[model samples]
Target: MSEATPPADAGNTVSVAVSALDLGALLCSRVCHDVISPVGAIVNGIEVLEDEGAADMREVALDLIAKSARQASARLQFTRLAFGAAGSAGARLDLGDAEQVVRQVLEDDRTKIEWSLPRELLPKNRVKLLLNLVLLAGTTIPRGGVIRVAGVGEGDGMGFVLTSTGTNARIPAGIEALAGGAVPQGGLDAHSVQPFYAGMLARDCGLPLRFALDGDTATLTAA
Candidate 1:
């Protein structure tokens, strides 16, 4: 499904027209969107109990709220690498570390994940690319199934292959095209959200996000 309507022009930018800073902002906001939900909810919850005085049930409510807020923030951070502009090269990046980070965040959810990879860190760009790739793969299934993830690292950089196999594997339209290059230019066209995010993130990181769609599964990868 198409992601929520992006917030104004900051969210939509043609490949050529988009700048690094713009892409950075887009990534930052996408990160914010996921994080703010639980954090904001927690804050509001706190104000409610604090102002009203902790009722008998306040302890349980506060505990659940706190746990959920932490989970949401962790997930959002993992998603930043996976779906948003993660980081640049020359910085410390561990694919295995990232994988664990993501899996830890996702484990709290109902989705059952099957993972395969060596304990190693990849370059910044490849890590970011794979994270986004996994996010896309996860979106394809609701009931959930096995996600086979394979990674290889070399002198130039690292590469990853993520396959989410399950019934009703419908990949998002926008992300499918983003792997090649450039989404068509327009004023917030219908199929212009995921691709934009993918494209912009790739551009910002100076990497490519490519989709390899074969039958029921899609693979996203880059260096």
Candidate 2:
């Protein structure tokens, strides 16, 4: 796997020719894609209830609708912290909020998150980087796993770590290359762009991302 740490453009520059609005739109598209299935299920359930005459079928449809709505809401909550502009200008985010959002995202997945940030607040940029790293690590454990996120040290000496372990754990192919500043021949789209985005966020936050993967375990450290 290729490993490189390139600096993101200073002053929040866009790496590509595309405008910032376009990039935001792309991220929004990704979020929409994720919630569409659950939202669609809810819509279908409502339609079924409206059309069906059988009370038992209507009850089942109601259950399906309730579950789907919860899933959609959770995804939206996660997206707000992970992708949306969450904090005010020059403000730190509450770690509790971050944990809550992370937990919500994990609710639907087989994976579990073990968060241990000793600090009560963190710079918004750091929180964004952390969430994105969690998102990246979440994709590695295909067969369910544990994601342990913790803060190490205190004050200026602080750093964050995310350790993912499970059966068949593996980083997605070409992600390391993307972090190393190599674009795939086919280019990146919504489905395969997150790892690259996380790398960029790390750079933007002036943090270095280091990863060590062996067998069914992967550890991501940022400082």
Candidate 3:
């Protein structure tokens, strides 16, 4: 947790013990949290459409419905790859697919994403780790910001960096600790469980996760 120290304890090697069912439940909760807003918008639009006296606003309601549907779909697709088995077993994930999903979710008025990774395919596990980092980084910018994702080096020595910058940007406290490999003394919940899961993935893959923060900017790296 220190600025000079790596995000994870270099010499320490312990992982939180989470049951399969518990992990599944937590992940599902995350997915629901992401999709609910857009889904609610869609329902509200339908209700507006059903109001005969709201004829003057029908076009606006339709536009709202369309936008919300797209947002909901984008979230579901990203979640599938990030939390579910998106591709075949033991195969490299398609970078195009990953980029599409990310851009759909992150490239909006509030945030912009720049993908600097190689165009070549990447191992599925690595892609998952990268996407989860994006998800974590996106939450840092409350007002508006830029998230730059880059893949560097090669093979087991490969490194991934995610940098976020904006007004009032900051990583959430409990999530940052969990993502950096410190298990909370209390049990994980829907909000704090994601970083713990992501950290475990990095550790099991023999990657070291680190974080550097300065003022309103933060960088997360795994190498």
Cα-based lDDT at residue 203, candidate 2: 78
Best by lDDT: 3
TM-score of each: 0.72, 0.85, 0.87
What are the lDDT figures for the candidates, one per model? Answer: 0.60, 0.74, 0.80
* Candidate 2 ranges with C-alpha deviation above 4 Å: 1-18, 155-157
lDDT by residue for model 2 over 140-180, one digit each (tens)? 78788999998866553456888899998776665555554
lDDT of 2: 0.74
In candidate 3, which residue ranges exceed 4 Å CA deviation? 1-16, 155-157, 180-186
Instruction: Note the residue pairs that clash in candidate 1.
Output: 82-131, 82-132, 94-121, 95-121, 179-210
Per-model RMSD to reference: 6.1, 5.0, 3.7
Tell me model 1's lDDT, rounded to 2 decimals: 0.60
Higher-TM-score candidate of 1 and 3: 3
* Candidate 3 accuracy as TM-score: 0.87
User: Better model by TM-score, 2 or 3?
Assistant: 3
Residue-wise lDDT of candidate 3 within 84-189, one digit each (tens)? 8876887777767888999999889889988887666777878788888888888778887999988868754566888899988776655556776665556667
